[model samples]
Target: MEKKQLFRNSVFILFFLCAAFTVSAQVRVSDFRYIDNIEGYWTMKTKLGLYAEKWKRVDDHTWKGRTMRLQNGDSSKVDDMRLFLEGDGIYFTIAAVRDSVGEPIRFKLRVLKAVGFVAENLQSPYPQKITYRWKDTKHMDAHFEGKDGRVSREIIIQYTRQ
Candidate 1:
């Protein structure tokens, strides 16, 4: 009986320690400014094509952004986007690009940091996970990954801040 009790106690302590470590390791709301810091013009060159992105700070809690395809130094706007930090998390919204702005689809932020973060939309088909990570002081990577059933795809675009 004594041996059984000691075993239970050890398991409880181990569980408690693990929980504490996990809580401490997770990113918090205070670290939600990852998108805010990247407010500027960025361009990426990939085998697919050359892409351009521009970020504008709308407010302390919001940012306006746009992604475009560049050909012969001319830009064709692709997606109109927004980043918002509110409540206990952050979100990304997509409204419009060319003609008319429609309803904004919001993707909730699941990861947060001062310089890197991740947001996800389970309802989206293409990019279910949007992660922004810094590769160096001047280079940043915007990664998009998702799995539709058994098919999974990922795209990583490295941006040089301008």
Candidate 2:
């Protein structure tokens, strides 16, 4: 029947459009390194803690990132960390398991308002209420506070594009 054929055609077209949209949303990971020629591993000592690791571009807009602490030198899992560009800015998320509390912690870094980067919720007591600030690519200055209105820690991190 004509109606049946029309319905089938509509479904096919819809499927094609959905597939195209999905592909477009997936950014290639390699494009990240092109930003500042930032490739390889680097480390930084922060007042909150010490972080060391490598951040390598895997494909357009996506990167393979990992971090470890200076105290024990236990390396973080690469699969747990990802760096990518969203829209005009770059962002990174590091998912770590807290050793002291045995809960999952996430450190999120996002570029905020013009030429500024915000490292929020590095190690947050609550999910939404966390630290934030503006920063340069090489150095970061921010403060983290707890719910009790006390300064948890202040961090100054220096980064090198390795």
Q: Could you estimate the TM-score for every candidate?
A: 0.73, 0.40
lDDT of 1 by residue, 37-95 (tens): 67788888877678978889988888888999987767688888888877876787766
Model 2 worst lDDT run, 10 consecutive residues: 126-135
RMSD of 1: 5.0
Candidate 2: lDDT over CA atoms? 0.50
Alpha-carbon local distance difference test for all models: 0.77, 0.50
Clashes of 1: 0
**Which portions of model 2 show Cα errors greater than 4 Å?**
1-37, 44-51, 70-80, 85-90, 97-116, 119-151, 159-162
Give candidate 1's error at residue 64 in angstroms. 1.2
State residue 6's C-alpha deviation in candidate 1, in Å: 15
Alpha carbon lDDT of residue 15, candidate 1? 100
